[model samples]
Target chain A: MLRTQQLEYTYPGNKTITFPDIQCEKGSQWLLLGQSGTGKTTLLHLLGGIRKPQKGKVYVADQELNTLSSTALDQFRGKNIGIVFQQSYFVQALTVGENLQLAQTLAGHSADSDRIKDLLSRLNIGNKIHDRTNRLSQGEQQRVAIARALVNSPGLILADEPTSALDDENCKEVIDLLETQAKEEGATLVIVTHDSRLKAFFDHKIILQ
Target chain B: MNPLTLSWKNQKDRPLQMLLTLLLFGLGVGLIALLISLNTQLDEKFKNNLAGIDLVIGAKGSPLQMILSSMYHIDAPTGNISINEVKPFLNPKHPLIKLAVPLSLGDSYKTFRIIGTTHEYVDSIFRGTVASGKRWEDLYEVTIGANVANKTNLKIGDQFHSSHGFTDDGINTHDHGDGFKVVGILNKTNTVLDQLILTNTQSVWAVHDHEAEEKQAPAEAVAADDHDHDQDHASEAAGQEDHAGHDHSGHDHADHEGHDHDTHDHADHQAAGPVMKPLIEYPDKDITTLLILYRNRTSYQTLSMPRNINENTDLQAASPAIEMNRLFSMMGVGTDALRNLALIIVIVSGLSIFISLFSSLKDRKYELALMRVMGASRSYLFFLIILEGLLFAILGYLLGLLLSHGGMALLSGYLEEAYQYEFSGWRFFKEELWLLGGSLGIGFVAALIPAFQAYRTDISETLTTY
Candidate 1:
């Protein structure tokens, strides 16, 4: 349901960083590996409508987010695109339950209590849901962010080096969760990472130097 | 529970800022309530002075001043008039003129204005029914209004001295006498009478050691003149009733003017009072003001006050209603300005709320983006910022209103007693409600800008670099 053709975006405020084209489609697990300053994040931002591509278009469900009003784009992004930051940032004052509730609220839906309980239980965070997000470890917080992203069942999932803070075992657990959860939700998962360890989780890979 | 609960949770995220906003709202609203309560109290105390009396007769000057001095214990008398003006109207024949109670005011008891008149004035004008004791037994004996008795703590048979001028700080000695017996104490009227000492006109003249008839009697002539004119007009209006044999009317008219004046000339007029023999009937001077109660509403210009004052008659007239309206308009501008300033402050507060919510969003953009990627909508993000603003504004408004009410309650009395004003605590007018709505509106107003920012955040960019 989501695809981008010849999506070109340029990094601002630099004479040397050039625009690049990217193409992607839904229902596929894709890996975008780029060296430092290769515009991987820029491309992702453009795809998410955080920054518009200087040229080309991104179509989600056959509709262009670029063509929609700024307000509509936010709603569209909130409901259909979930991004996981390398360093997870949750609202500090809120408990885990509240953090997820915020995500659901931002997506313009009430928190589904039953679905939330099941998701937390599945993610092994059922007990942590009522605890303050700040009290959780980096790995735990990352899981919370992931749960928040998946709460609305968006069609596209974006993860940016999400496993950087976790050890080898927790990293595997997180990666597996993303892959399996995306498959279950019928979502296209795109992970941006420089780590070779995560390469095996996806079927297709694009490496940038 | 609603989205705004987050701001409440995050209050310490900007602790000083939150406290400052609360303080600003509280202080601003408190000042407003303070000024309002003070004004109300002053108005109340002033109102007490004008309470109960139907009319005021005086030499025409400022109606406000006359009311202030005669009805209230503030300001000085414009001058006095010969009572001949309202005397003719005091005719028992005139169905309308109930009692032409003449009031002569020149001296003051302490800071309270001393009213010199007959027992009729003591009964009707002062409305004192011997709360503690008997009526004035002799010249120089007096009945004190409620506030006066309270301030001095004088009871029946007590004697108190008077002061010369209307201000307590004045150096002049009491001209009326060394001491006047407290023959009567009046209940509190909460009006000008509260600050007065009432005595018979003969006593007033006695203090000056003047023959009573020469100075006091002619003051009634002023009311008589107006009384007679009104009677002539009434007679003309009733001319059609001539066939009904107006002999009763004619007899009443003659007796009305004839008996009172002629009776005083007689030795044993029991209604005259204890010192009636020495009251030394001058029989002409009337009260300081004629409280002209007309059937139709009359304008100040039409009150014949200017004509009375113009002949250098030492008399001026004033309309209480006109002066009061003027006072209200004059005060309204100041109040409106203050309220507007309050509104502007609220708006500024709202803008600060917007800045706080919007700028804070920059740091939280990544989390927001993640949520968006996870099936959250742009509207959801927008609501987060707006709700934050809503949270801040409403909290401020509630606290401000509470502070306002508390301040009013504390200042109500000081405003009334000290400033000659009136104030009611816990009493809110419609204007205060408007203030609340306007204050709360600031949140929404500030929200519009930040909502724009949220709608524009890039979910992809907000996520951290790999």
Candidate 2:
């Protein structure tokens, strides 16, 4: 479960950048759609505990993120929030397995080998787990990023343009995977994207202008 | 990569920088180790060899110079004395008297000093019998030093003419009438004993026999002239007849002059038996300087002895223990300064490492955000950057140590040959080790900033940057 109240925030730079209020409960699929420079990313960052709002409170599973110490915030964020970036960047030195292992370590948990293998195999990247990251294709790398996000079975999953580089077929497949995983884990799923094509897949929507 | 693995990869990325850093550190570490090692070794040698029969009797001079020459076989000798002058203290039962070993310095065969003493020289100071070959059997017999044997390849039965003094140039040759035969080779004492050419007391006197003989020759000429009249000049007339006989034969004409001189010396030898020869008299030469070993060992002072001698004089008093300490402590300033310089360099290097990794982290903010989106934590990201810097520092330290020893090893051989002081192996001082640890600490501290920076990234801003 995740929620944000009144969530007022400024960019903390010279000019103020503010986020609209927001909340999400357990097992919900919410599409965060917004025009460019409409505080979508700023709100997403605040929600992930990366930026303290300077104005509002964010809660995940009823724990206030804004109140946590920087160190505590890091641990809590790593354990509870899963984010998919527009570009999935893996540690170049590590093999795919180590990338996932590091993710679990950051979350203060150990990797679930069987479950991770199961996810990779489902994504058709099972054999690539031991390979160096530079060897992976973009589609396969994105799948690994997804697997790493879900390694610790976090309470919430978030994606930024989760399928920006895929064809319609691959895009459909990635979205299905994220939705199915969130449902199976009973976790909240939130996606920030400009593509209205994925709008049908979500049960709720937050549109900002 | 695991942190170490990732850090190690940096060397591959900048091999030249890594190598340069290693070389610099190695030189610094190596020099320090070598100096300490030599000091330790010298201390051991001094402690071991300087045991036993207390006093060193030599000519009056700088007592320190006297001890150095007579005791350590180094430095110029104080002076020389007649063996007969030291006879008063030769008694084994005299009060305040213990067994004494006399040393006379002068002469060398190829830089190895020739010290004229009895077997007591080995018995007292060196404390061991010759490892190979027999002890000196004749006045002309010489003992090769351990280092001499190793370097010169001289074995028993080898003969070499000793120079008159400690100079290597063969300008002053000892005219001992008979050249010295190598009778023994001593074991490595690792002390100045390793550089001495030891021989009997007779050898010292015999080596200088030319001077005594020169003085005797003129007197003998006068005595021959006087003795001819006492024998009613018959022998002289017969000698004239012999000279005339040689001329008549003509075959012995060139030898006639030589025969006349031989006959003269033979007559003189027959007339004067023991009275003409110089002999050891112990106290009579007045031990120019006494190296006194006291029971209390509390101080260096002893009753001043007579300074004048029949043939010996220069020596100065010195205590090796106190002098050596003073010598080493004088280097404290240089050592402190060098240590400080090394520490500063290490700190600067650490700062460089921190700056390099920290900047790289900032540039990769989006990459880090993506990893977080893929489930990597701020701590994991933080550790990666910090570990890179820490690894760089550790590697640089190791390289410095190796460089130092390798360089020292190369230089040590040249130093020993040129300076006669051997260089040492890897030997870091206690304070030096602390400096090394401090360097690593600086590296770790420098890395902390970047690691913390990585921890506080705005996931959304960073993710969008991608």
Docking level of model 2: acceptable
Question: Which has the greatest lDDT?
Answer: 1
TM-score of each: 0.65, 0.70
User: How much lDDT does each candidate structure score?
Assistant: 0.64, 0.63
Identify the runs in model 1 with alpha carbons over 4 angstroms from their true place. Answer: A1-30, A42-81, A121-136, A154-156, A165-173, A176-188, A200-209, B6-12, B29-66, B75-99, B103-304, B315-394, B419-422, B440-447, B461-466
Cα lDDT for residue B433, model 1? 69
lDDT of 1 by residue, B1-466 (tens): 2456765776556688778876675556555555565566566664554544545656555666666655554555545555455554355454444555556665565656677766665566546566777666666778887877777787778876655435565544443334677888776665565557888765554443222222235554555643543354344323332212111222223434543433432333234456554222353433455554432335553455435544645445455666666777888899888867865666567667777777776666665665565444677667767776666667776777678777677766665455443456787766566656766677677777776777666665555443
After superposition on all C-alphas, the RMSD of every candidate to the true structure, in Å, is 12.2, 11.0
Please provide, for model 2 over A1-209, each residue's C-alpha lDDT reduced to its tens digit, 9 standing for 90 to 100: 77777777665475566556677878898999987777776777778776667776788889998787766777787788887766777766567887777677657676567777887787789999899887988788788888877777888888878887888888898898889888887888998888788988887999977
